[model samples]
Target: MRNVVLGVANTVAAIGFVLFASIVWSAALPLAIGLFLGSLLGPRIVRRAPQTALRRGIALAGLGLAVYLAVEAYG
Candidate 1:
């Protein structure tokens, strides 16, 4: 299944990221703090948002990122 393949890919990517992070010791603390804060506050924020609003927000974010990348690549 596509989900199984994606899950395996994500797991492998996560392991690779951990290995890369271990080599970049200085980033560990900041990444840890960010992970902690996101874990703590992310769900709470999402829970309060309406589903439609959340969907639009995600779409807008993706669109913005695509535009930024396009500009960076070609402008």
Candidate 2:
């Protein structure tokens, strides 16, 4: 399924980010803590939300980012 693939990809990306932070960033501790908290709390928060609202918000955000990128590209 698409969600499964995306979830796997996101996990890999998160691992890569943590590895990079550990190797290069002195703020890795805080970064790791924030990531840990997000991982712990994010699913619980999202699970209770309305799916339609979340989808709409994501679409709006993507559209806004696209418009911003277009303007930035043209300017």
Candidate 3:
């Protein structure tokens, strides 16, 4: 989980840097603030959550999304 988070963070940082000139500050500023706040608080919240339960919930959600997409595509 830690590796996955780090991988995505690094990739997003690179992409944002490359597109720095094209980003609309008006639209991105509010979102950037929200994300900054979430980054500060999310780890504290996750530390208190049950690991097994979190894993189960995530697996179920992935499975549900896969099933939904499959049905939508084949129906």
Candidate 4:
């Protein structure tokens, strides 16, 4: 139920991003920024208390760093 809604919303967002990317000059930058923010914040919203928060924060930081490197390598 909730998962399905979230999945659908994410899919719609992805499609919207693709459509916008096709027409926008520098869409990748915004996409990257969005990814970074989502990675940094999403876990905090979903994770339980205590250790989960720490784990999620570390995971998000790693994701952000990886995205940054990938963008720099390709862009």
- Output the number of the TM-score-best candidate: 1
Q: Where's the lowest-lDDT run of ten residues in candidate 3? A: 16-25
lDDT of 3 by residue, 1-75 (tens): 999999899999969876775766687889889989999988997899899998898899999999999999999
Candidate 4's TM-score reads 0.35
For model 3, the stretches where C-alpha displacement exceeds 4 angstroms are 1-41
| lDDT of each candidate versus the true structure | 0.91, 0.89, 0.89, 0.85
Please state the error at residue 26 of candidate 1 in Å.
5.0
Model 3: what TM-score? 0.47
Tell how far residue 24 is off in model 3, in angstroms: 13
Residue 44 deviation, candidate 1, in Å? 1.2
Decreasing TM-score order of the candidates:
1, 2, 3, 4
Show model 4 residue runs off by greater than 4 Å: 1-49
Compute each candidate's TM-score over C-alphas.
0.59, 0.51, 0.47, 0.35
Report clash pairs, candidate 1.
Answer: none
Off by over 4 Å in 2: 1-34
Tell me the lDDT of model 3 at 69: 100
Pick out the ten consecutive residues of candidate 1 with the lowest summed lDDT. Answer: 19-28
lDDT of 1 at 49: 91
- Listed per model in order, the count of residue pairs whose N, CA or C atoms clash below 3 Å is 0, 0, 0, 0
Taking the tens digit of each residue's C-alpha lDDT, what string does model 4 give over 1-75? Answer: 999999899999989977775655387789889999999987886565577777888899999999999999999
Candidate achieving the largest lDDT: 1
